[model samples]
Target: MFGKTINEISLNDTAYFEKTLTQSDVFLYAGISGDNNPAHINEVYAKESIFKERVVHGLLTAGLISAVLGTQLPGPGTVYLSQDLKFLKPVRFNDTIKAEVIVVEIDYDKNRIRLNTICTNQNKEIVLTGTALVMPPRKRMDI
Candidate 1:
């Protein structure tokens, strides 16, 4: 059920992915991305900062948006063209975040799509907002 082609897509087509952030999630992201900022990994250092608590990496939270696009809406073969994001709030450990995507426009001639991307926490606070441009998978030709 992956790889929905441009012809099969439409305005307002949507998808979502949800996950609860964990300490291990933060640590692993830090390790893999080499973004071991004190605000994200050191509770003591974080306590001294404005947020007053360890916060998840902004990009880590934003990845949920990628999750939705790659695995749900256009799925599998979708090629991400670009994304513009704004981080609105801090996400602490244990926050359940849901990333959502909505097709705001489509360019049939170019096979490109513009999508409204957003992420909200369990408390329904918008943590991130963005727009993404993607090329949905091409139609498969019969063998």
Candidate 2:
């Protein structure tokens, strides 16, 4: 199925999705991704690092952005073209991260849109910020 088609979308449109990171989520991600860095699983090892404790993988946290884009903003049929991200803070277990996407530019002829992506923690601090280029569904798809 598709979300809002290009014709229905407008600049400044926004969407949000959030998740509370847990040990299980991190472990599953680590298992699937094979990123067994000690900082993500070994508490003792991470305690010695700057974070002072285990931290969730940055990419894992960033996935929330994908969730928003693929399910809420441009939705189901949206095709992500590119993204530029900056990790501003460490995401620890049990932190609730809210991901948001806002339309900033649109090319009707090209069927492309530029969105500002941002992730914030429960404390309202920005953990990640980025921009993405995507092509929303050309027409609604109902299956």
Candidate 3:
């Protein structure tokens, strides 16, 4: 089914992409999203917190999934309808994180799809998991 789906549709079934989390990424995200939480930016404060180190924003990992969905898997012309996520582990700076997405369901009539999304670290520990609903480009033209 994987090979067939890949040939029939442009959407990707499963993929792995990695990025090294940096202090700059946290700071940039903070500046752009107004999420200047100490856990995300202040190493000293983070050291005293439960995590004992700076942790990236949960939304940051979630955003990575959106990137894969919009740019790689379903690619362009895909409409993001909704997403649900659960943060399982903390993501620390300098950690190499991998994000993956797989098609779970497809609604042909509405051109909608459901994908299983995941983010993990180099140790293969899952940092996040979720489901996303998107509208991929249809195979047929509508008048």
Candidate 4:
């Protein structure tokens, strides 16, 4: 039973993953989020925009953080408490974005952790930066 007990996670632990946005991803997000802003889906409209191309939704990029926290770093069964994001650059279609999470703080008593998260594109430009709070499983205590 001791071996099965939930273990604590540390800040030094890290998880890195990458994903490339496709036209389908753009379309799906546009459809689901109801954010059919021309900048995201309309080619002609996007061409005239500052980016000169269709850009992925900021929320889509931020969503990668959820993947990192729920699957890799803290593994399954982790609960996301909150996330704060800043969009620094635009993420365009066909852009391969890399998401990284570095554990920053661990609250053992509360079973919570703070992570410094960032998403960067192929150009190595940081498109998003933020902090994520997650609740990982903890060893059960019995009186």
Q: Which candidate number has the best lDDT?
A: 2
lDDT of candidate model 4 versus the reference:
0.83
TM-score of each: 0.96, 0.97, 0.87, 0.88
Question: TM-score rank, highest first?
Answer: 2, 1, 4, 3
Model 1 global lDDT (CA atoms, 0 to 1): 0.93
- Candidate 4 total steric clashes: 0
- lDDT at residue 75 of model 2 (Cα atoms): 92
Tens-digit lDDT track of model 4 for 73-128: 77666778999999999998899999999988887777788889999999999999
lDDT for each of the candidates? 0.93, 0.94, 0.79, 0.83
Residue 105 Cα positional deviation in candidate 2, in Å, after optimal superposition:
0.4
Evaluate model 3: give its TM-score. Answer: 0.87
Q: Between candidates 2 and 3, name the one with more favorable TM-score.
A: 2
Local accuracy of candidate 3 as per-residue lDDT tens digits, 3-121:
12222453446755689888998899999999999988888999999999999999987888887766666765567899999999999888889999888887766777788999999
TM-score, candidate number 1: 0.96
Give the poorly placed runs of model 2, Cα more than 4 Å off.
none
In the order shown, the candidates' Cα RMSDs to the true structure are 2.0, 1.0, 4.6, 4.4
* Pick by TM-score: 1 or 2, better one: 2
**Clash list (residue pairs), candidate 4:** none
In the range 1-143, model 2's lDDT, one tens digit per residue, is 55778998999999999999999999999999999999999999999999999999999998999999898889988999999999999999999999999999999999999999999999999999999999989888553
Q: Ten residues in a row with the worst lDDT in model 2?
A: 134-143
